[model samples]
Target: MRKTGAVPVISGAWALPNAPQFSEGIAKAKELCRSAGGTFAVLNVEGEDEQSQSVLETAFRDARSDEWKEFLADCLKFEAEIAKEISIEKFTFAELEEEEQSLERLRRWFRDLKKRDALQLPAAEQAQKALNSCIDSLEAYAQSVYSAQNGGE
Candidate 1:
């Protein structure tokens, strides 16, 4: 992703009832951003369901309310602490397949989400920014891997 000269922001949500690996997962993702030269952030919010859109919208809006901005600032600090625990690891080929699968899952998720009668994510575009980063990162990573295999031709 760094090869493109475009900055990538790696972000994800740490929803309620978090698993034991949540911190590790976030830290690992942060490490990826670090190695690739990008920003790392997380949204620590409750509930990992469609009902959480309003909360995300408030946080992601262009002119976010002061309260939400402060909340996001706190989340950033928390994410920074989590990032401190990052343990460097190899990016396996299997993980690339997993990332592709996640992209398909994301597609299904958004399709189902739009089928709802009360879809209210006005800042949905803001969310798309993150997805675009993932796509760009995936392509860049694949390119780098291929180049390595080809002896850096």
Candidate 2:
């Protein structure tokens, strides 16, 4: 979806040794931003969903609340951990396809969630995992596909 005047932000940590690898995986992320003529920042993303957003809103209801900023900082730490568990080059072609399929399932699940506001935290967490898995898979797949099509550099 083309965000209307929306900038691209790479939410997650990018300072550790393996951080560069994660960023490299999503190199197109910057390209995506450029194509859309938007800004890009490699920041951590925490509480991206409604529940977390609510917590933030409640914690600091002030117009200039910094709770959201703090949440993003926490998210960066979490992203670093996730990156340790799964690197950019880890997925295979088959796994990439599986991740893609899983993402589709998540999309359907999230859509269903629209009608139900009482969804459990676990379900929401699972959806997030699926989304991340799909991103990693696609990144690996793109790398492989590009290399193969170019006869491997």
Candidate 3:
């Protein structure tokens, strides 16, 4: 699952005697997050198998704390940019003169994002979920606009 604005906490169970690939996946995820200006954490839990999981856990948790805040800020800024794109696309003269039906969808997405920001999502998962919802709304609006332009149902 994709996450935003905070370190992703990945938790799952896998049989022991696992190869380095599993740890590599975690490392790759962290590397990807670093590239995106975010953070990642993989919590490998296999039913109290502490001896086996220590290596993976130690590597995952070694992330610098200072990066978390910077990552979160970058993520939020990204979300805001997405929201602005929706606004610009939805309310454009072409869109306004074309598909009026989609205006409500775009307005609702903007309002929901605003409301959620005010409410403070309280967790990374919740914030990510909210961002996904915003994307869904925006996509739906775009689809409606395109469908109207093309005379498609």
Candidate 4:
């Protein structure tokens, strides 16, 4: 989502009544991609009745097109800068007082990437894997600390 050299495809579903908001979301997403120096396409499915199925089918067809495939391939190249900005080792979970803050920061970073829709990139996925590993280590450290403080209760 940080404009890593990729084309992002934003998809959404909305009832006919909320079409305006759905369109706005797509527009905003497009702008975000553009600001990041990338291109974006949108697939907005609208309707609540049987027509909805047809709309979705058409969307599916478009999604399966060669153009969409190229778009996805392009998106895979996105490189998230946060992956380099935050080092997992920096949050070692060594002190009980700092453990919560460390976890919160890691979670916030992860959530920000997700909100920015960067999870689709391979780099983002790698970052997520690293983040999960750090979270696991931190949780284990917290457990050990708790056990030590509470006599393993």
Candidate 5:
């Protein structure tokens, strides 16, 4: 995920088998936060196989500490920089004319809003499930094709 000014917390299983990759993820999150002038944190899960909802809650709370004042400040500061505003709702409609830019921006924002509204409907939830299934199937097929082309290497 692209980094913003928000504090990042990497929550993962740090088992011996995957400790290196876990450490790498932590390092990357730290670098992203530091580059964006924000602090970084981590939630080191003990059991590789065990998991819970609290970990997610704790990470979220950690990021939004101080009544969200720090996060708000960081976000405002980051959003002020012209070159770094590429997140959702942050797209600058770069290099467009004044009139076209405003129109396009509103159009995209409305489209996203409509999508959010649609996702709250039952039909959209069913469609999302079907789309996820199709994606998984396609991914498996692609992997099979790649493996075949590699002579089962």
Candidate 6:
């Protein structure tokens, strides 16, 4: 018997530290689904699924709200502090020349955090623990931006 359920597909472009292009990411996800012998369907928040649409609308709306903007700003401050502690000069969450470079900067910080014996320090420990959260928040912010730009297409 074949499995029957919605298979969640995500594009690598949706990964953190990289700007998300929703149309391209969705296209890639659909292609992956097809190659895996599965069907793909785009979820439209304003479409037939009223309940799901309402939920999505609320969530996206909140994400675009001032609170969300402040949260992202705070996250960026945390990232910058971590970067500075790790000696990553000029570190920024702003889109860089190459997406990979932004990712590499995070990777470098993580590595330095691990190799250093000064994890007992407050700043180092904060930076070490914030790695995952930083990435997650960044990804969410990227998705919010994408949804706004594409009108959740």
**Candidate 3 lDDT, 75-107, residue by residue in tens:** 465456446646665444365343333434444
Better of 3 and 4 by TM-score: 4
Q: Please report how far candidate 2 places residue 147 from its true position, in Å.
A: 1.2
Q: For model 6, how does the per-residue alpha-carbon lDDT over 1-153 read when each residue is reduced to its tens digit?
A: 001111222452111111132355456667888899987665432436888546544443432343324433555775664445335332333442233355456656455333322112344445544556767644554554455556656
Candidate 5 stretches greater than 4 Å from native: 1-119
For each candidate, the alpha-carbon lDDT, in order, equals 0.43, 0.43, 0.44, 0.45, 0.38, 0.44
Point out where model 6 deviates above 4 Å. 1-103, 118-125
Candidates ranked by TM-score, best first? 1, 4, 6, 2, 3, 5
TM-score of 3: 0.29
Better of 3 and 4 by lDDT: 4
Q: How well is each residue in 15-59 modelled by candidate 2, as lDDT tens digits? A: 211223344434566678668987755545567799975654443
Q: TM-scores of all models?
A: 0.37, 0.29, 0.29, 0.37, 0.25, 0.31
Poorest lDDT segment (10 consecutive residues) of candidate 2: 1-10
Write one digit per residue (lDDT tens) for candidate 4, span 1-153: 212212223442222122332354556767987899987654444458877766644443443343334433432322122222223323223464465565566566555444333224454565566666656655655666666666658
Return the lDDT, model 2, position 59. Answer: 34
Where model 1 places Cα greater than 4 Å from the true spot, the runs are 1-92, 117-120
Please tell me which model should have the higher TM-score, number 4 or number 6.
4
How good is model 4 by TM-score? 0.37
TM accuracy, model 6: 0.31
